[model samples]
Structure formats: C-alpha cells, structure tokens
Target: MGLPARRPHAPAEGRARGQGGRVMAPFPKIHDLYVSRMVVMTVLLTWTVLVGLDVVNAMISEFGDVGKGNYGLLDAVTYIVYTIPRRAYTMFPTVAVIGALMALGQLAASSELTALRALGLSRRRLSLSVAAPLLVLTALMMVNGETLGPWGQRSADGMKTAAKSKDMAVAQFSGLWAREGDIFLNAQNGQEHADGKDTWLELDDVRLFEFADDGRLESIARVATAEHRKSGWLLRGVKRTYFEGNSVTQTEVMEEHWTSQLDAAALAASASNLWRPRYMSARDLRDGINYRKRNGLDASEFEEHYWGRWFYPLNVLALCLAAIPFAFGTLRSGGAGKRLFIGIVFALGFWLLQMQFVKLAGVYRFDYRIAYLMPPVVMLGVSAWLFRRRSG
Candidate 1:
C-alpha cells in the first residue's frame, strides 16, 4: 500500500524559503518526512516481533522454578513497550538509511524525484529536507533510551523473576571478590533465591573480606540454603566463622538469615541483565563502561557498548549514507531485492565484527578509541565517500 501523508513539520523547518540557490519545497519535506516516518514505523514493527521473540527465548532459557503469572496484561504491554525503544533506536538509523534510500530510489524510479528536480528542487535541498526531520527523530530516540528503556527493563525483569520463581534457584558459593566498598557474590547457580533484580546466593564455601570499612573481616556467614523472603533472606542450617584480630570464632546453628540493605531488584538486574546491551541506553552504557574501568576490570566490552551507543544514531545516518551510493551504484541495473539482501549482509557482518572486536578488545586491553571508533568511523567514512562519488 502507498505511504500515508507526511504530518505537519515541528515549526522550526516550517519557515519561508530561499536559503541557498533554493530552499526545500514543502512537498519534498512533506514527502520525505512521510516516507521516513513510514520507514521507521515499519522498522519498529519488525523490531517488536524480533525483540518479542528474543524476550520469549530468554524466558524460556531460564525455565527454572517458573514463579510468575502475577503481573497483569498491562505488565506484558509495558514490557513490550520497554523493550522496543532502545532496540528501535539501535535499528532506526539503519532503517532510516536504507528506508530513505529505498523510498527515494522508488520515487526516482517512478520519476517522482526527477520531476521534483526538474521543478528546481536540487538534490542538496532534497537531502536537507530528509535529514532535518531525521535529526529530530534521532534526538527523540536518545531520550527514549535514557528514560523509558531502563525503566522498562527493570519492570520487565521483575515480572520475569516472578514468573521464573519456580526455577528460582540460588547460587552455591563460588568464593568472593570485592571492589570499591562492595563485594560481588557468585554462586554455582544464581537464578533463584530472590525476587526483583537481586541475586541471593546459597553459598557453599563462603569467603568474604571487607577493606574500606575496617580492613577487618566484618562478618562471615555460611549456610546450607539462603531462602529469599519478601522483606529479607532466611538462611537454613547456618554457620558463622568470624575473625577477630587473628583470633577466629566459630558459630553454628540450625538456621540463620541476613537482611541486606541493597536493592534486590538493582542487584538482580545487574547480574541477570548481563549480555543485553540493547536494553541499555547511551548513558546506561557509559555507567556500565565506568563500572568496568573502576574495577580494574577489562572494560572493552562495556567500552565498545558505550561507543556503540554513542555512534549508534550516527550509524543510522551512515547506513542511510551507505544506501545512497549502493542504491545509485546498482541503479544502472534494476533490482531492489538485491540491494536489500546486500544491505542485510552488510548490517549482519558489521554487527558480528563489532561483537568480535569488543571481545578481542577485552582480551588485549586495546585502546578504547581504537576498539570503538574504527568500525563506524571506517564504515561511515567509506559510505560518505561512496555517496559523494555517486552524487558527483
């Protein structure tokens, strides 16, 4: 079906014309916005399906102690909305790039662009008309990434925990590690033992130490199983091995538990939320980046994540730029299908390379700039060059 008409402009670009040899024609701006919006919406719908599949897949993987069915349909709707924006943001640029080109190329093929050009609408004006709305869109996407994306993630994660409570397995003790003032806990298993975002481990051989507070072993508690109740935790079959100045005290009991002050949801979110950078925004990515840096941990993954976020909107623009040359490059021949296939291959390859490089960056401690900047930089620069060559 044909695209719907362009909505009115946001007033800024709705001004009177004649900036250069020409200002953008109202129809061109209107047409481009209409098409770009359609492109974006199409991309978003596709994202919703794919992301929905992914969400289901993830929940399926954690098919442990399924404890949810608590949240209402509103829960699912909110989660669906939450999941889309960041993903949509990531994909929007590519959509705009490819979609804009496809739309324009279609227009050109049908002689719409040619007619407009003949009517004194230069290619420059046309590009400006198209890009101006896109810039605004990019900004809106960034905002969604910041506000809604993470909030949705937390809420959705909570629901998942409730659903997966049956499989709510706790981790067995995997020793202890500390950074800053807080120590990170790991168990043989971490799926259960808590509600919300936190992971409460049923430590097998618990080992803990705190340096900042007193440089002394504050308190060590080990138990057979730490069951997470709503307010706090209930540890069954407990033992406490305490250290005092070189003296050690041992206490054993049938049952014990600790109520932690930290937000369980946030902690659980951190542990389980690993590997899903698509849910994180640019700012969230930066926080993740900084976390790795402060821990003296290899941060290339987070660094790459940060770069991906920072360069993401630009990537969209780049993809659009890339499509321009390709659309025109293969234009002499006539098959939109081929261009699309090639674009898919290109997008996939680039994403795979990004994942591989980020891992390699972690392994080698490569410079953040080198790891993050190179791909988008190189791809975008090449795309720009190609577009110039085509237009020239």
Candidate 2:
C-alpha cells in the first residue's frame, strides 16, 4: 500500500485553537481586556450616579443647618467634598455589584456572552475576567480609604466643629476615653499631627484619674498640655490633687514627667464617630490595637473595625461575584434598569444584614473576626455553588 499522506493543518484552525486543539486559550487576552473595559466603564458610571444621589441627599439633610452658626452653604459643600472619599469607600461594594450585573446583563442581552460560550470560554474564566479589574479597583479604594479618607474626614470634622462651637475649636472634649492599667485618661481636646508611624496626639486640657487596687480614687492630675514622649507623657503646667482620708491636698508644678503606657494610637482609636474606624489605615489599627493591648486596655472595638476594613475589598468582590449568576440566569433577559434595581435591592439587604450582624455581635460578645468574615464567606460560597451548578 501507498504511504498515507499527512494533511496540512488549517491556518484558521491553528490560530483560533489552543495548543491542545481547543477553541479558546485558557485566558484570552483580547476577550479579557474587552470584558474588563466594559465592566470598568459601567462601574465608574454607576458609581458616579450613586455618589451624586448620595451627595444630593446629604446636601438636603444639611441644608437645615446651613445658616446655623458659621456653617454656610459653602461650608456644607466643602465638607461634602472633603468626605467624598469616605462615602465612596462606604458605597463601593453596592455600586460594584450593580455595575457588574449591569455590564453582564448587557452582554448577555446582546448575545455576546452566547458567542463567547460558543468559543469555549467557561463560566469560571469569564467570572475571573470580570473580577480582575474590580480587584484592582478594590486595592485603589483601600489606599484612598487609608490615606485620603481619614485625613479629609478629620479636617472636615474640625472645620464643622470650629464653625459650630468655640470650645470645639480649642478646649472641647475629644470624646475619647481610655484606661491604662490603674489610670483612666480623658482629654477635652487633642490635635493630630501628620506622622506615619506614630499618630501623634497633642492633647489640650487632659485629665488623668488614678485608682488604687481597691478601686478607690487615689489621685487626679490635670494638665494644660500633654504630649506623648518616648519614655512617657510630657505634661506641662500639671496640678496634682490627692484624695486621702479626711485630707485633700493639691499641688501644682510647672511641668511633670508622667509615666503611662497610653499613646496617640489609643487616643485616636478611642475617638467617637467623628474618627470612625473605617477612616484608619491597617497600620493605624494594628498599632492602636497593640498599644492598647500592651497597656492593659480593651481593644475589642479596634479589632472589629480593623478586620472589617481589612476585608472590605474581599467582601465587595464576593458580593459582585455572587451577583453574576443572577445577571445571567433570571435577569439575563431583563432590561438594564431591571438589573440595576435588583442589584440595589440586594445591596440594601446586604447592608441591613451587615449592620444587624455587627449589632448582634456586640450584644452577644461574638468573635469580631467571625463577625467580619461571615458576609464574604457566605457570599463567595453561594457564588461558587451557583457557578458550579450552572456550568455542570
């Protein structure tokens, strides 16, 4: 018999197929880029709309107080501008889901997804492509939240306080309370300086109440100005009052070297809603927790906030991923508005559940780490199962 002739490979087939003779590469760069770009643009537009709505609502809410004190319309606008980053961080997860869903729904509606499926792109690969750009966005958001959000929030709050009350500008309470071993510390006013490693707090009118082992008041020290030094606190113009049986004695000193373990981290961490945990960076939260823990202070709140902020991006990505199946399955044939509305509904529910969980955790003394991780884990789990079922 004659030798069997070898057939030449088709040029089109060679170019279109993978090395293993599949119709698609493991990761198609052009397809991934196209999907990523579409998703990113949709997300940006959706996020802008959400932010605008929020801004309008905020302006309306603050309009009532616009003329009060020195807080004019301009001040309100400035305050909104300053706090934009924080708001963006807070609303990111919701807008991310809405945007991704809208993008996927659009593609499905246009039969682009069908074509991709025909080209041998699996759901898993497509999901990853959609997730890639969002991961980058989440990282950028982390940076913005850590750097710009805190600084801007602090400045806006100071401006609002100064406009509202004279005491707030100089001698008002910082709403910070901390316990260091046997001593309890409180500050009427404090200023934060720009120091990356140590959040320097320059306290004005600080009060230190000391207690004995029996929980009796031992003494009270009042300082006009207090700054955290390497060794301890440098208290200027200190007045010490002794609470002894049947005799109360008072002494004053030009300056005193106070030995205490509390630092700027503790003060900033203990600040009330004005300095919320979401504003602090990971490093800030870690340092604060360590300082407070080392000083025999409770760090539960800081730990909770730290974990929540640290897992923020992951939580958002999970929610977005979880939302993909809805866009492709039931909502695939729906209009963009329909998908967006559904996304909003889901986002609102997620926020409500998150808030409720946090509140319940605080009441029940649940583990902060678990409380922070619960939402993301559940979201991702559901997403994985859905994708598996759909693909199977």
Candidate 3:
C-alpha cells in the first residue's frame, strides 16, 4: 500500500503550535489574562478622571463656605481630602461599567476581539473573561465602602462640624439637636458605645430648654451626661432651674428620667457622624435597623439602605456584564463618544430604575429587598439574552 495519505492540517480555531510545533489547546487562558489587564488599567484610568472631576467640583463648592465661622481654606481642603474615599466609593460602580465598555470597545476597534472570536472564543466566554477583573474590582469596592468610605465620611463631617462651631451647642451643625413638644434638647457631643453584646449612645453635656406654651422661657436643665438605657434615657448630674417671673428656684439631682417621644435609636443614628444612611456600612445599617425596630420606630429607610448595601456587588457585576454586549455590537465600529454615551445611558437608566423602585416600595409598602433586586435581575436577564443572540 502506498504511504498513508498525508493528513490535512487542522484549522487554527482550537489549536495553536507551541515552541516545538506541538499542538496546544485554545488560548482562552491567555485571552482572559490579556482582557483582564486591559480592563483593570482602563478602569483605573476612568476612575481617576471621574473622581478627579468630582473632587474639583466639590472643592469649588466647599470654597464658597470658607468664610463661614472658623472654616478657613485649610479646613475646607482637609474636609475635601477626608471625603475623597467616600466620593471614590460612590463613583466606582458607574466608572467600572463604563471602563469595561471602553476597554472592550478599544479591543474591538483594534481587531483583536475579532481574532479572538475567529479562534473559537464564544461571546459568553469572552464576557466571563471580562467579568473576572470586574468581580475583583467589585470586591475591593465593597470593602472600601464598608471601611474607608464610612470612616472618611464620618471624619470629614466631624472636622467640618468642629470647625464651624465653637460653642458646640449653638450651631446647627454642632451636635445633636431635637425638639419634642415644648422641650428643645441639645447635646454638645454624642458618641456610640458598645458594651459586650449591647450598643448605646451617650450624650455629653446635654442641655434641655423647657419653653412655655406662649414662647416664654420656663426652665433650663443641664446634665453632665445623658445615657440611653433599655428602660429609658437617664440624665445624670442634673441641675434644673425654674424661671417663675421674678422668682427663680434651682434643684440638683443625681439622676432624672427623661420621658419624651424621641427615640434613643433615632437620636443615636443622628448623633453618630450625622448619619447619612447611604454612606453607612452594612453592619452599622443593621444595627440601626435592629435598634429602630426594637424601639417600635419605622425602620423602612434603614432597611432600604441595608438591603441596598447587601446587594451592591450583585448590582455592580450585573451592570458591568450588561455593558459588555454594547461593545460587541455598536462599539465595534463606533468611536469613544458612542461608547461614553452608551455607558452613561446604561448607568443613568439603572440609577433611575432603582430610584423608581424605591419610590414604589415606599408608596406600596413592599419589601425594599425586592425593590433593590429588580433592576439588577432585569439587567442580568437582558445580558444573557444578548449574549445568546450575539453568539447565535
């Protein structure tokens, strides 16, 4: 028999020659590595540009407040510096999706993506490769949100408050101030304290101004410390002075019970770093929710934030994945403007959808967890469909 007919060379779709001309498996790993590096670098560049712009705008706004009280240029700069982490954390999700889009768009423009596709890399596999870097970024952002973001925000607020208020009780931003009926209460400062398994708020140098119904000054009480307990609020080192026309009487007490409609948990939330629920960590949010619930307060807002924090990573990943399909389609022949527009549209749409769901949740009294999940779930479904269609 003649020598066996020479076998035809295999197509290059799933095989490549190694150093010795031996066949190697498809280069999915190499593609993944290459894509990951490009995505990460693009994300950092995007994050820097966006955050820098945001910080500049904030600095301009802060400068306008420099002349107020003791808030000078230096103080304003310090405040802005401290708030940078919070700003970065807040802008990350939007930046990440946009950056991924730009990176893939660049790849498509360069024809590298086309080569990868021709080499039998499915769109789904490519998307997964893109997702790996984004997932890593998402984890880092989550950590920043919980740690640096909250810490920086709290520190910035404290610095601003202190700089603006000398008396610490007269300024609006000084400390905790509240009104319950005819009693106006002010705390020079307040701090959250943890005792084993329990946590509570302690108000230092608490002052209570009891006004008459007709707006006359009736009495004033000063307490060295106000502590919130399970039973009620306890005012220690109390000194009460009564104003009865020309007659005045003073009384001193070791402690007194403060009976009012104010919830300690609510006060604690306000006292702890001027609490903006959006900036708080999930742990703090949970504590707030539990505290408010135990005191029979409406925990809807806290619950909303708590659930949102828990779902942040999922939302980010979904948005990033959803953004990739655009690169494979319109971005292949499009320029940076188109990529940016697509990114903005997706980011804004997702943001608006989330806001609408939150409003609906409030109006309909539904679980906020469901509301937070809806946007990401919808995006994920859309992404899956697009990948399938594109691959087909």
Candidate 4:
C-alpha cells in the first residue's frame, strides 16, 4: 500500500521525528586542535611545576657548597633551566599520548565524546586527528635532543666545575713530580679536555740533565711541547746533547709517546677531579669506558653510569609512557591534587625501577643492548595500545 504519510518533524516543537523515535540534538564535532592543545598544556604545565619544585629543593639542600663558590643562586638557576629542555622534550611525547587518552576518556564519561560519535565521526578518525599533533612534537623532540641535550649538559657541567673545583684531593696530576735520574717531568695540572675525550697536562716546563757516572754535569736539555695522546703524553721538540773532554756527544729529538704509570682516567681524576655521574654525555661515557677498558683498568663503577647513557632518552620516554595508563582512570575520577600524588608516586617508582634495572644489568654483566631495549619495548607498546584503545 502507498505510504499513509511520513510524520513530519514537529515544526512547533523544534524537534525531528524519525521512524526509530525522535532524532536527538546533533552532537558537537570534536576539534583536533582543541584536544591536542588541552593535552599539551596539561602535561607541560604539570611536568614543569613538579620538576621545578623538586629542582629548587635539590639546589637548596645539596648545592650549598657549589652555589657558595663562583656559582650562586643565579648559576644554579641557569643550570637547572638548561637541564629542563632535555627533560621536557623527552617528557612531551609520553604526556601527549597519555594526556590525549585521558582527556578523551574523561570526555567520554561526560558524554561529550558520545555526542561526537553520534555525529558520524568514528573512533578511528578521532584518534588519527589527536595523534597528528604528536607526530609534529616527535620531530621537535628529536631535534631538541640533538641540539639542546648535549649543549645544555655541557654548560651545566662547566659552571658546576668552576662553581666547585676538585682541588682538595692530592693526586698524580695535582702534584705529581717524576724524576728518573736526569729526566724530570713536572705536570702543573692535568684535567679533562677536548669534550672529555682526552686528558691534558698543563706543563710550565721540563728540565733534563745529563751527568757522567763520576757525578759531573755533562749537559742540560730544555723543555718543549707537552700534549695528550691515547697512550699518554706526546712530548715534542726535545733537545739533548753531551759535552765531555772538549768533545760534544749530543742528540736532538721531538715527538714521543709518554706512557706513564698514570693512565688517562687517572690524569683526569688528578686535575679535573670535579666530574660527577651527571656530567658526561653518551659519547663521553662510551669513550671513557673504551679508554679504561683498553688499559686493563677496573672502572666498573663508572661503567654502570656510562652504559646508562646509551638508553637515557629511551628510559626517559619509557617512564613518561608508563605514566599514561596510570593517569587514565587511576585518578581521573579524583581531585587534581589527588591525581598528582599518584603521578608523583608513578614517577618515583619508574625512576627507581629504571635505576635498579640498569645497575643490575651492569653488575651482573648483562647485555646492555637488551637492557636498553627492554624499557622502551614494554612501556611504549603498552602505552601506545592503551592510548589507542582508550581514545577509540
């Protein structure tokens, strides 16, 4: 039979009538920018506030001696800020993923997301939209690390050293004087140089004396250039001669590798005794390990922190990612302050676990590559899936 007639939407009631029932009000369209911006702000602001507070407290408590030197509150502030960009860059992607998941989840609970779904927007499209901004940030983070992380670390270390020199401890380079018969070597200073790849000796001069077995002075040789080498010092432009019984037996030479009992690490320790675990870069750590390893040096202690460098950024990212699932609903229903307490706990736990894992890996002579890869694999996989499903 011909249709009796379609019921018209109620013109007077301002509602659409459909076969199913009544058409609900159209849902608001989800905006990509709005979601990403909100997430970025929340994560960045939270991280900065929390980290900044911790930094201030740490400086006050532990930096008293360093800050009292040429370094002051201003220097401490500079170093802290310089270090933040690296920390923040690593923190961004993680928070972006988690925050987006969280922001979307909360919206879902409030029905705001449901309304968007009703408007013909699929969960997949919504996820793609939110994750787009994260891709851009990923690029930024890569560049930031390549540029800022290395430089900032270096600046912080220099100021810290000048702020507090390791001049107290006496060592081979600090006041090492060696005299083998007529050959005398006095190193005024020995410190790390050339981006900590090599050790340098500040030599005021050197004095060499030639003597007869009868205890008579035969000749004198003046000092020359003293530079660093892999084996040891490269002393150049040496002038030596012998004068006896109106006859001159003399020799002039330059360029020699001075492999002393003191190794490069030992030299660095003697002069620039101010290095800390946080000072060296990834490359520095690698080279340091190689130098010590080649010389049969027992430096498993520094080796622990050294191996940690290769995975540092990864670890940072992993911690941030692991934090995502926790923020999802762990405290989504709670007050902001309550959520933060849980966040801090998450951060501390992540740090401790990472530290212990790295240390254990080093102590037991575990494979560093596996250890480095594990955290990223676990955290990033879970976080990625968790965020995708949550957003979906």
Candidate 5:
C-alpha cells in the first residue's frame, strides 16, 4: 500500500504548478521598493518634460531683454541658467501629482494594478507605496528650496542687475540704490543679523543725498551703520555736509534719527536675498515673523507664507492621493494621454481652489494657517471618500 500522494503541497501559496508538475515562480513581490522605483522614474520623466517647456518659455522672454544696457544674449542665457533651480523647486508639487497620476495610470492600463489588487494589495496599500518615494522627494525639495533655490535666484538677480546698470550695481556684498521723493539713499553693503530669537538688517556705509526742489544737492549725510528699529531707522556715526553756494558746512554726530517714508520691508527685500519671504527658508521666515512681531508691524503675509511652507508636504501628498482614484475604474481602460489630461485639469483646479482659500483668508482676516490647511484637509477627505467608495 504506497503512501498517499501529497496534494502537491497546494502549490506552496504563491507558487503555481505547471502542466509538467514543475512549480512556477511566485508572483514578484510588489513591495515599496518596486512601486517606488516605478513612481520615481515616472516622476523624473514628467518633471523633465514640464521643466523643459517652462525653461524654454522663460528663455524666450529673457531674450527680449538682451539689448537692454549691457545685457547681451550670453547674459540672458546665464540669468536663465541661474534661475532653473528655483523654477524646479516651484514646479515640483505640480510635477509630483501629475507624475504620480501618470504612473498609476500606466499601471492600471497594463492591468498590473488589477493583479496587485487580486494578490491582496489594497488600493490604500498601493497609495502608500507610491507616496513613500514622494515623501523622500519632498524632503529633498525642501533642502533645495533652502539652499540652491534661493542662492540661484539671488545670483540671477545680481547678474541681471549688474548687466542692466553701469552706475548702480547690486550684489550680496555690494550696494543698491533707492529713492524717496528727492532724496536718494545708498547702502554700500548690507547683512542680516540674528541676535538670539530676534533678527534684523544692518546696512553699512550708508549715504543719503537730499536734493532741493530746484534740483540742487542740498545735503549729503553719511553714516557708518544703519539699523531698523521699532522706533524708526537709526543712523550711527553720522556726518552731514550742507552744500550751499559751494561753501560746505560739515557736522558730525554719534547718532541720528533718519526720517523718510522709505519702506523698511522694501529695503530689506532689495538689500538681502534672504529677506524675500517667498523664497526664504523656514528658519528665515520664522525669524522674519518674529522680527515683524517685535517691531509691531504687520506680520500677516509672513505668517501666510510660513504656514504655507510647513503645509507644503501635506498638501502635495493629499493632492496625489486624491489624484490616484482617477486611475481606477473607467480610467483603467483609458489611454495614457487621457489620464495625463485629467491630471493636469485636476492640478489646475486644486491650484485655483487653494488660491481662492488664500484670498478668502485675506478678505476675512482669519488665521493664515487655517487658510493653508483647509485645501489639504479637503483633499484628504475627498481622497478618503473616493477610496472608500471604490473599495466598497
């Protein structure tokens, strides 16, 4: 009585028995690594295409300015090159969502997603796997925004300024010219300083030229250092020369209160690249917020950008998740071009929605953080509802 034949061990779970009784290979593991690679490759491809178009448009616009001052074609090209990092940083969120949608769309088109689902991988699980790579990319983009993006923007700005002006030169270590009424101001150099939790801008070798109504130079004041204080601008080590009929009278003072309508914010923005809240890092934004608050100035705009920066990752991921549902159902049978069109429309709609929320916040004077948060929160809710419906 021979031993009963084992039932071929039930094909060992994922293993399949062929006609010749040879066990076939198990289905390839579709873990985070495999999904992440697909998503990342698609994202890179999409980013390249989108960024290339954007750069070309920018080059065309920049080329129009080539003949202005000493700004030749080479200068225009150089300026565009310097700004690419910032452009990449700015476009990444849009690129990420579109890329993710295209990736999943391809998978669904190939029926790989159906296979994954049949193998016990839920849509939620696949969504997470896709998000993992984007999370890493978000972190990398944050760093790029802080470092290369701002640096490149500043360099581009400086290069353009230098090429466009002979007497007025702008650089990190150089100076910029600003005017208020008949008075022209120049700061030989400026630097941002941080003292504990407080931050401020200090200008060195400050010069102010006050012109008379008749176009005659009334007086020239020179200061060693100029600082913006809550009270007003404070000029230290001041020397003033009055030019009346070619007989100059010089007066020296240890300190003087500068009176002018020149905006401190504008000065900071022009003097240092770090002061532009739009391009500033989280740390710089925080410092700017603190400084504005301490000075009793309006900090709403800074707060808006600060909260926006912090919520960037959440917003991007939520949008991507919301976009994923489009790849399933009817879209599964659709062409890749159709999916891409849908992704673009979705991204544009989301951007418009976000802009509306921001505008509403400004109109109603609500907490800017709430404004920044609502879009992502709405996206996440929508995603969850769609996923639940699909799963059901």
Candidate 6:
C-alpha cells in the first residue's frame, strides 16, 4: 500500500465539510451579511410602498381643504410632503414586520433557509441576524420622531392654519391643557389676534384650577374668554369659586387680571392639536412633568406620554421580534403577498391591543410607566415563548 492513495484537493479528515469531504466557505459572515441585506432591502421596499399608499390617501382626504383661504392645491401638497416623516414614524413597526416576514419567507421558499440550517446555522442565530438591522432602524426612527417628526407636524399645521386665517391656530378635537406655577388651565379654544402694535392669544371658555402646595384645590376660575395682553392675561366674564373647609364661596367678576409665568412664547410652543398628547421630545415631556409636579397638579398624562416616547424603540423591537416565529413557521411556504397580508393583520391586532391597554390603564389610574410598557412586555414574553418552542 503506497501510504494510501493521496486524494487531490481533498479536505483533511478533521476539517469541516459541506455534504462531502470538501472544503467549504465560512458561513457565519457570509450568511449574516446575506440575511441582513435581504432584510434591509425588503424593509426599504415595503416602507416605500406603504408610504406611497399613505401619501395618496392623505391627499384624497385633505384635497377638500384646498382653495380654502390661501390654501391652494400646491399648499396642500406641501403640507402632505412635510408630514411624511411623522407618518413614516407611525408606520415603521408595521413595515418592519412585513419586511422581515417577507424576506425570511422568500428565503424559505427558495430553500436558502434550509441550506443555512444544514450548514449548522441555528434558528436563534438567524433571528439575531435579522434583528440587528431592525434595531439600527428603530434607533434612527426614534431620532426622527423626536426631531423631524414633531417639527414637521407643527410646521404643516401652522402653514395650513396660517393659510386659512390671519390668526395662526390649529383646531383640536378636545381642548388645550396647560400649567403655570399654581394654576392648571384648560382652554376650550385658542386663536391669535393681532391689533396694530400687539398680537394676543385669545382663549375662549377657559377654566383655571388653582392648587396649593399641599395639593389642595384653592379655587376654580371659569372665564368666558381670556386675552393675552402685554402686562398679563386678562380674564373676562370670570366666575371664581373658592374651596374652603365645608363651605364654598362663589364670586363673579366682569374682568380680572391673571398674572403668571405662562406667556405668549410658552403657550405658542405648546400650541398643538391638544386632543391628544403633543408630539413632544423626551426633554420637553420631562420638563412638563416637572412643572406640573411643582405646581401640585396631576402629571399622570405627561408621565404616560413621556414613557411612551422614551421607550418607543423598545416597543418597536418587541413587535418586530414577535413576527419572526410566524415567518419561520406559518409563512415558511408563503409568498411575499401572503406575508404582507398576515403582517398587516397582526400589526392591526397589536395596535388595537396596545390602544385598549393604554385606555384601560388610564381608566384604572395605573402607573404611567407600567401602562406604557405593558404591551411591549407582553409581546416580548410571547416572542420568547415561541422562540424557545421553535428552538427546542
């Protein structure tokens, strides 16, 4: 035996091989890069399609407002364009699911996933590979939401309002809520009124609840209208009720001058569609909460808004992770359209559940942090369970 026939171009006995005793390319970097590319590409494509549909729908809904005041067709288009970032922030999580599911489904359909598995790639590893790019995207979206989203939304609303009226004011479905040193105020409506040398913010049906340092209600002031003057706010047609031990004293005044720290600039900054929490940055939310706390007013709503904004990226990640198992199992053989449909259905369900939880939390007066975090925690738990089951 001539020292055993030497095999040409054959891998050594101890070397790892692919189906045969032949050398194979390193799968980790190659597969990871490939999977990341597929996910990112699909995400971009899905996001583009969804944004296009959203733009068309927005145009149709807003077109009726065209030609109102100075708001022409061009103005409407500009308003819609400016709001694209905000809408994209709202739609990101849905597209993340759709994109990841479609990409993985495509790979499964083509047997690429099967090949990767045969090459000793674990499902958990594959999941992480897919998640890495999504995590980066979530961070980017958070930045956009904090900066461009709010700015654009405010600018668009201001443009539309300015076009419609000389006074720049955005209509809110509910009303405006604000706070000063000791006064918590709710204005049913607000508009700017410019007269010669001065511009004033005219607030209608204003209610002010004055609180003491001990968190006791000192008095309630109801004004038919309040106007911002250079010196201070002038409340007209005022009815004030003082809260004392066991007895309440009520007095009516034709007009009273209200003095406080809240001014035109502060009110202008907070002037937004107040039916919902304003799209405030984390810093703004924190300062608002602190101001409310210092004034001995309830900061529950601000707390909720703060946590919701602060933890947005985590919530998005949880939602995206939850969709992975569905991609690998139910949608393994499905096409991109099927994946898209399923992703939409699931995304809608998630949104409904999240809204319900938030509302219920408010009704029950639960902790704001808990209320904001509950949905993401549940999603993360479900994902973990499904991932373990699949891996096991």
The alpha-carbon lDDT assigned to residue 294 of candidate 1 equals 66
Local distance difference test scores for all models: 0.55, 0.76, 0.82, 0.56, 0.79, 0.78
Q: In candidate 6, what are the lDDT values of residues 1-392, reduced to their tens digit?
A: 45887665432222446676554545447788899999999999999999999999999988998877788899999989989998898889889988988898889888898787776666766888899899899999999988898778767876776675443344333355666877878776555667897888877678899999999999999998888888898999999999998999999999999887675664554353432345656776686678667746566666777788877787778888888887667777767778888778768877887778777877899876676678888888889899888777
lDDT score at residue 125, model 5, on the 0-100 scale: 62
For residue 326, model 1's alpha carbon misses the true position, in angstroms, by: 3.3
**By the TM-score metric, which is better: model 3 or model 4?**
3
Candidate 5: segments with Cα more than 4 A from true spot: 1-30, 173-275
> Please, what is the TM-score per model?
0.58, 0.71, 0.73, 0.54, 0.73, 0.70
Model 2, position 306, has a per-residue lDDT of 86
lDDT of 3 by residue, 220-314 (tens): 99998888877778899999999998999999999999876676765765576565678788998897788667756567778888898888888
Clashing residue pair totals per candidate (backbone < 3 A): 22, 1, 0, 0, 0, 0
Question: Candidate order by lDDT, highest to lowest?
Answer: 3, 5, 6, 2, 4, 1
TM-score of candidate 3 versus the correct structure, residues matched by position? 0.73
User: Residue 78 of model 2: what lDDT?
Assistant: 92
Identify the runs in model 4 with alpha carbons over 4 angstroms from their true place: 1-30, 66-110, 116-146, 163-277, 298-332, 380-392
TM-score for candidate 1, residues paired by index: 0.58
User: How do the residues 201-234 of candidate 4 rate in per-residue lDDT, one tens digit apiece?
Assistant: 5442444555676878787665564666666667
- Give the range of the ten consecutive residues with the poorest summed lDDT in model 3: 165-174
**Residue lDDT tens for model 1, 186-245:** 332122354578546333323333333645565565555544556586666766677677
- Model 5 C-alpha RMSD vs. true structure (Å) is 9.2
Kindly report which residue pairs in candidate 4 clash with one another: none
